[model samples]
Target: MRKKALKAAFPHTLPVMAGYLFLGIGFGILLESKGFSFLWAFFMSVIIYAGSMQYAGIDLLAAGASPLYTAMMTLIIQIRHLFYGLSLIEKYKSAGKKKPLLIHELTDETYSLVCSCEPPKDVDPSLFYLFISMLDHSYWIIGCTLGALLGSLFTFNTAGIDFVMTALFIVIFTNQWLEQKDHRPAVIGVACSAVCLVLFGPDRFIIPAMISIALILTVFRRSLEKEASDHEDP
Candidate 1:
């Protein structure tokens, strides 16, 4: 069952693997350029495990940000995970011993893949999810470590490499849009974000955008679910 689950999970994570490795390498290089070692890259990828926040962290470390400030910024940056976790509570209720790890490793990419893909025949859903999480995590660790090592050995222009994460997100969003017949959720998200961006500016928009998206989705959940069901029917 585990073997089958791993096989099924690997293909779903390939896109993420490509993204994470490149992004992770970029992160490692950035960290290394800041005088941190490859071990820092490996440990952060394992312990912190948040792509965006980890990128932010390098700046924080360099400036010697206070722990309280770091904690607050981390919360603000990762607040969207609250919504992600809420959406998955039902799906992960039966995860048992694996629930904690699942919650720990539920990055944006992993969440998208797990929510969209299901286990094949005779494959345990829990195992499939776990395998996907583990594989994605490993890719990131390897990427970050390799990037750090490369940075130490060679000199190259490292400007704008951080944009890889943004590019990966665009790809994920486009893929999701193509895969789902229902576009209302996507439309809602984009509209809310755009409005918030204009109103609050870039730095302050994320939390408000997330709140609005969650509220709107909840308000229209029944109708959206019905529409999706109708579309799925023959």
Candidate 2:
């Protein structure tokens, strides 16, 4: 079951593997540039498993941030995972022992892939999801480790490399938009985010945007579902 799940899950993760390798390398190189070694990258990648947070953490650690401050920062950055967990609650309820690992490894890439891709017939859904999570996690760890090793040997400017993360997210969003016929949720999210961005500014926008989006969706869940049903029927 595990081997079959691994094989079936590999193709689905190719895109994430590519993106994570590059992003992970960028993070590793950045950390290396800050005087940390490959060991730091490896451990952080393995433990944190949060690409963006790890990148941000390099600076925080460098600055000698307090533990309390670090905790708050991590919560703010990863607040989206709360929503991810909510969505997958039912799907993961019966995963037994694997449920803990699944939740721990639920990175954005893994969530997107698992939420969108179903396990093939004959493959256990839990195992397939586990493999997807594990594979993506491994790619990130390897990429960061390789990058740290290479960072010391090569010295090049890395000014715009961070943009790769942003680009990956845009690509993901675009793909999701294209795949879904009911654009209401997407439109609401984008519009609300834009309004919040303008109102709260970039530094303070995310929380408000998330709150507004959640509230709006919750309040109108019935209508939205009905509208979606109407669209499919029509």
Residue by residue across 1-234, what tens digits does model 2's lDDT show? Answer: 778999999998887887788788888888988889999999999989998799889999889999999999999888878888998999888899999899889998899888888899999999999999999999999989988989666567756765655665677788878988888798888999999999999777888898999999999999998888886875
Q: What is the C-alpha lDDT profile of model 1 across 119-230, one tens digit per residue?
A: 8979878889999999999999999999999855646675665565567668778988998888999999999999999999988899999989989999999999899889
TM-scores for all candidates? 0.88, 0.89
Predicted candidate 2, C-alpha RMSD: 2.4
Predictions in order: lDDT: 0.89, 0.87
In model 2, which runs have C-alpha deviations exceeding 4 angstroms?
154-175, 228-234
Model 1: weakest 10-residue lDDT segment is 153-162
Steric clashes per prediction? 0, 0
Best-fitting candidate, scored by lDDT: 1
Worst 10 residues of 2 by lDDT: 158-167
For candidate 2, what is the TM-score?
0.89
Error of 2 at 19 (Å): 1.4
